[model samples]
Target: MILVTGATGHLGRAVLDTLLQHTAAHQLAALVRDPAKATDLQARGVSLRVGSYTDPASLAAAMPGIDTVLLISGGGDDDGLQQHQNVIDAARQAGVRRVAYTSRALQDPGTLANELMVRHFQTEDYLKASGLGYILFRNILYMDTLPLFTGPTVLETGINLPGGEGQVSYALRSEMGEAIANVLLQDFTDSRIYHFTGAAAYSFHDVAAALALASGRPVVYHDVAPEVLAARMRERGVPEVAIGRTIGFMTDIKHGQESLVSSDLAAALGRQPTGLLEGIKQLYQL
Candidate 1:
């Protein structure tokens, strides 16, 4: 059976939902820290295995009898790499055959700016050295997060960032989930890596133009220095560490680490992925 960890999370839930359409619930198991959060999945007849990434014993219990395991990266906090290490060790001990991981899309994984991406890089290295067959999903920034960079009222505050002229191959989280499910449903046995990014790359200016067109309002793109962006985030009550991390991502983009576009996502979905303007409309309800 295929076991999906983080079954209650946004991406994990989407993957399970897509899997239900392609495979029976009997062939699947969901590992979640809180079984109560997985009631909907359990109702669909999927086996619920209580597990925590911090608890190796629980992860070991969850991995037995599973042929394929999707180890969704842990929370955005600093402890995520440690949690992933625990999961990896347990999966190996439990005799899981195939493992898949979600990693970030970056031109240089060694960049020190974004701690989140750094941890993903570290986890990828760990997974590679584990002697197990693995698949790496190098996912780009989510288009859904575009709405977050813009203020509550997108049209009013427009989009502000430290990204300058940098471009991002932003893909929708839903389509990414679909692509991952498609990968797992196939006869994928060998270790392979796929860049799960949008079919096209768009600059912040292009995103602003798309938003303006979608909202029928002039939404300008404001490019500021990293420190200015950090100050803005701080003024909005974002935590210091989070603000630093956000700035780090922008720094990575500014250094041209996020501009790569790939056809792998389209091939995985068997169709064209959503474009910037349409995705903006869907996200903003415009």
Candidate 2:
């Protein structure tokens, strides 16, 4: 059986939805901290293994009878590296054949001083050292986050950021989940890594044009300075830490860190991934 950690989260749920289409529900299990939150999954005949990555004992108890485990990256404020280690160790102890990890798609995570990417790199290193076979899904930024970066009134105010002209090969989260599920259904004898990304890299200017086409209204992209963007966030009462993180990601884009386009996502899906204009329309419901 296959078990997915963080089963109640957005990407986890999307993976489960696609898995259910190709396999029987009884062949799947979910690793959840609270079974109450996963009642829908239990009703669908998927076994629920209550566990927490912070609690090694819980993770160990959740691993019996599972052939493979998908360790979805944690999003909490706590130490994520140790949590991932706990899961990996538990899976190893339980004799799980393979462990799949969701990681960031960066050519060199050390280029930037971002703490999150550092942890991802650390986790990947630890997983590699662990004796079990592994699959690494180095995913790029999601198209779903476009709304968060640009405000709700983006159609009127335009896309203003410090990302400069650098482009991101952003893939839809749902499509990435589907591709991950496809990998999970296959044999896990050989370990592999995939750079899951969209078909093309696009800049904020391309995003503006896509928005204009989708909404049938004029839109613009303003390449503001980092200090100017930070000042605007301060005016809007955004937290200082969040402002720093936002600027850090924009800087990574400015340096072309997320500009690599890969065909792995489309190869997994057996078709070309959605283009920017179509993805924008789907995201905005336009």
| Predicted model with the maximum lDDT | 2
Q: In angstroms, how far off is 115's CA in candidate 2? A: 2.5
- The digit string of per-residue lDDT tens for model 1 on 175-244 reads 9999999999998679999999998889889998998888788988888888888887888899998888
Model 1 scores what on Cα lDDT?
0.88
Q: Estimate each model's TM-score.
A: 0.97, 0.97
Candidate 1 TM-score over all chains jointly: 0.97
Give the C-alpha lDDT of model 2: 0.92
Error of 2 at 132 (Å): 0.8
> Model 1, poorest ten-residue lDDT window?
108-117
